[model samples]
Target: MTQTTILPIDALFSRVEAIFLKAGLNAVQAGALARVIVAGERDACKSHGIYRIEGALRTVKAGKVKPDAVPVLDRNEGSAIVKVNAGGGFANPAFELGVPELAARARKLGIAALVINDCTHFSALWPEVEAVTNEGLAGLVMCPSYATVAPTGGNKPLLGTNPFAFGWPRKDTSPYVFDFATSVAARGEIELHRRAGKQLPEGWAIDADGNPTTDPEAALAGAMLPFGGHKGSAIGTMIELLAGIMIGDLTSPEVLDYLGTTTLAPFHGELIIAMSPEAFAKGRPGDPFARAEVLFEAIVGAGARLPSQRRFAARKKSEAEGVSLTAAEIEQLDRLLDKGLDAIA
Candidate 1:
């Protein structure tokens, strides 16, 4: 077995932030990026963890993302829509900037939407959804990625492996949350499989000729399949319409066209909707939180596990102990910190 090293969560965050700062990201961008990345590692979500660092650095090195851009928030008063322009920076900081206002607006209006535009988004959406839940609101987050997944009946890459996430606040314990790629698996998973010299599960992707492929290299060069065929295809299209076109941002195809290569993080927008459960449940039959808990108890009673339960368990373990990384991962972090953008290419 490979040896591993455990580092405290704060220690890992400091290292990640240092890497981004060395790559020229501003304090806001670097700090926010570090928090989400560390959270992913803490929760055992390896696809969004340290493995993503090099791609972010590569984007910065190629000038595809602005390392020093500070996100600007627009309150858009009296409207249900709040806007944050990422100013060509990473989406994490922009989401951080707008979330407070989003929570406040949702409480005041019963529902509100935060529209983040012109951001290079590469992280998982659960962190953002959990952020909303932290503010005692339910949240739904979605974003379009590089054109990577093929539509149900299509042979070419069109729809992205668009990710969607939802979260509900809980009075005790971790919030209820679920985050997943609309594709059979996230593109990051395939990349990880490639790095480990592992073949993908059979239904995950197709080759350039649209034939099923288990090879990661061929899948990367071709197209990923949607999760539930037509159902997933429709939802992916809906994300493109709502998060992309409706928000006046680039669609998946447009993102692929602009990026020219999927090697870098895709430049796009994100949609985050926040809703106040209490406000929605006002003057209703019973307490919404109470009812939700009862439903959760029933699900568990039936021997069904809740979404994100394992993740929360991992997070608890990481908090008490520390994040564990293999020797190679540690070396990679050291190299990234020492070489900055040059470590990628």
Candidate 2:
């Protein structure tokens, strides 16, 4: 029975907000994060949306994430390089504060970087990257997380399932954005398989013994493998350094230690860079968008779709007809709703 529930996007927002509120978020805070979650669903980013909501609430209850946290701008507040300390809160609003500021600085200075530390990221990176590109600037954002995936050729997990996001804008089409996890299989995709009692495909993950396994539960209990083997692992390592050593944020080992003590959201860090072509490239007559559109046409004419075409296609269809969710998901939400709001915490 293909029982799919189709609802307006706002309905999803309201449901997510209600759940966040029940999990101890104020209206403003809940609204801020709710938007991130909703945008994930809107873009068909299943892993970063509903799949991780419960974990976010659990972290809040565990005191790993502070609901009322406010990020403090560091001493280098108003320069080309920007930094914000989240004091161990959600990274959604932190990026909300940093993206626009970074875009502004990049517009004026040609390029700018923003580093946010001591924050927990619970959503997709496209929103932040897209935000910068919307301002007519190129954007690249890298976020390092806890050690869930192992480095290539290593038994134990050494690095986070880091996300690398980049965006380029176009004049006649949607922005070109690519946001992906370095793991062979995304964390949420693994979770979905586990929930459905299905095994993961080959190359996704391995058992605790270092041998690869198709068992989703065992893989989750052990570690995820890097996509493309060492190449992906190397990129993950680079992202860790860029978002950690480069900016001096809490690294993966520290996050693993923090997780050992509590089930809360692990404090993490993010690196965001924005560049304006008006300042860097041919300034007067060179239109970056126009140049990119030519390549886009070439690629499409060659019968190849771009990186984000599927997501853009999905978003268009969803906007017109609405989005669908499995009955199991709705049932889970209903069960959570049935539990008294105060009791959820």
Candidate 3:
């Protein structure tokens, strides 16, 4: 068996934060980033975990993202739409700055949307979705990435891997949450497969010649297929329309053009819609939360697993026994802290 080292979640977080600080990221940017990245690791989502640090550092080194940007919140009083301008920084801090107001507006208005603009996003959408659920509301989150996915019936890369996430609050237990890339897999997964010298599963992607391929490098050079063919393609287009075009931010194609490469984090916008279940169910016959629990129990009773169950299990284990990292991963973290951006390339 390969040897691994276990570190407390807080210890790992400090190391990650230190690396970002060394790379010149401001406190807000670094702290928020560390929280999400560490949470990814703690939940066993390796694709978005510490593996993402290098890409973020690369983005910083390229000057494509502002390391010291302070996100500004525009309350837009009496309106259901709240906005946070990231000033070209990482998206995590912007979402953090806007969430409380989003929750407040959602409670007051029954539904509210938070629009995050001018941000470099490289993390999973589940964290943001969970944040809203923690506020006792249901939430939907989505964002466009660099163009890397092909629309159905097309071989060229036109749409982003584009993630979508949803969360519903559950009392006395973890929230009901699901987060997934509209593509067959997230772009980060392909990168991780390449690093591990592993072949991707069939149907994930095609080569530059538009032929099916399992080679990670070839897939990276070509395009990833949408998850459910036309269905996923439609959802991806909707995300681009709602989160990109409607929010007045960069679309996947525009992002790819502006950056001219996919090596850096994609600069785009995010859309988060929060709805108070209590408010929505106020005049209805049943309690929404309790009703949801019944539905959840029935599904599980039929042996159908809920999404994120494995993630939550891993989170519980990590909290109890600490996070386990391969020796190479630990070494990489040490190198990052010591060399900062110089360690990335």
Candidate 4:
């Protein structure tokens, strides 16, 4: 594989969008997904960055994701929600559909909760949370997936490394955005480490026998451990109840049905909560956005950077210079592009 410099962010985004467009996505949807990718990179979430392209395209080629499935919303008294049959399309649009509605709902209800179903792989929830934050609202999102995790002490993998993300509006500071998997690390990160033939950090994953293992390959074959041990396990269990049981879109069952085997796919069940500051602030801080700026400054000065700050900085640098690419990764991208071209041919 020949090494080549990473494409500039704009160039990278365009190239990424082209791949999706080739799979039949509309321009708007492509743009939305690109935004998600760029944001993930910017926020230093490399696992969700360009590495996801090939896997996503594979799902598209398998007819698991429809390239043109737009989400439709259901409005009712006091609350509004949407059922996205992304028809096997990308997850971003399905989640993006909630953005405007969540903001509107916050205006009316003071708080709004959105549930997403049949959505494809939604990447980092940070960007979406940040979106609501930018709009002067507090937003929290959680997504549960199928079993790739062994419950705290169990040998059987019975839960997904469910993720919960939150964005809170702060007066005079960047919104406090927290996004993380219930697992010690996300499955995608494990996958990336495996691809790189690297070992995992301590206490992250366990082998099939439920003993900790540093080998990424073993972890992949086995299961990941939850964070904060039992406490985090409880949170993941709660997310499963919220995203799976409540929504009637169980991730494990769906994985079995779709994959024809019990192999897991990181399908997600997501919830987004948007709360307006008008209820709490009582109109004193008229501009919630301005309040956010102040809080951001204060927090940074206090030696606390926003969640994903490192990633955001990296992304900014990358956009100005170029996206980082190892020779191996570039080769992989070329191979993926070739496969995509072959699909059309």
Pick the TM-score winner. 1
User: Please, what are the lDDT tens digits per residue for candidate 1 over residues 199-223?
Assistant: 9998999989998999999999889
Clash pairs of candidate 3? none
User: Which residue segments of model 2 deviate by more than 4 Å?
Assistant: 1-6, 74-78, 191-199, 213-218, 261-264, 283-285, 321-345
Global CA lDDT of candidate 4, please? 0.71
Model 4 steric clash total: 20
The full ranking of all candidates by lDDT, starting with the best, is 3, 1, 2, 4
Cα error of candidate 2 at position 107, Å = 0.6
User: Which residue ranges in model 3 land beyond 4 Å of their true spot?
Assistant: 1-3, 188-202, 207-218
TM for candidate 4 is 0.81
**lDDT winner:** 3
lDDT of each structure? 0.94, 0.80, 0.95, 0.71
Task: Encode model 4's per-residue lDDT on 1-345: one tens digit a residue.
Answer: 656676777776776777667656777567777777766654557777766676666665566666677766655455455344444556678667767777887777788777777766657678878888887788888777667777788775677777788887665445577888898987768888989988899988889888889999889878888899989888888878887778766564355455553222355456777888776677574666666677777987999767766765676677677876677766665665556635431
Arranged by TM-score with the best first, the candidates are 1, 3, 2, 4
Question: What is the C-alpha lDDT profile of model 3 across 110-186, one tens digit per residue?
Answer: 99999999999968899999999999999999999889998887878999989999999999999999998899987
**Count of residue pairs whose backbone atoms collide, per candidate:** 0, 0, 0, 20
Q: What TM-score, over all chains together, does every model reach?
A: 0.94, 0.87, 0.94, 0.81
How much is the lDDT of residue 52 in candidate 4? Answer: 67
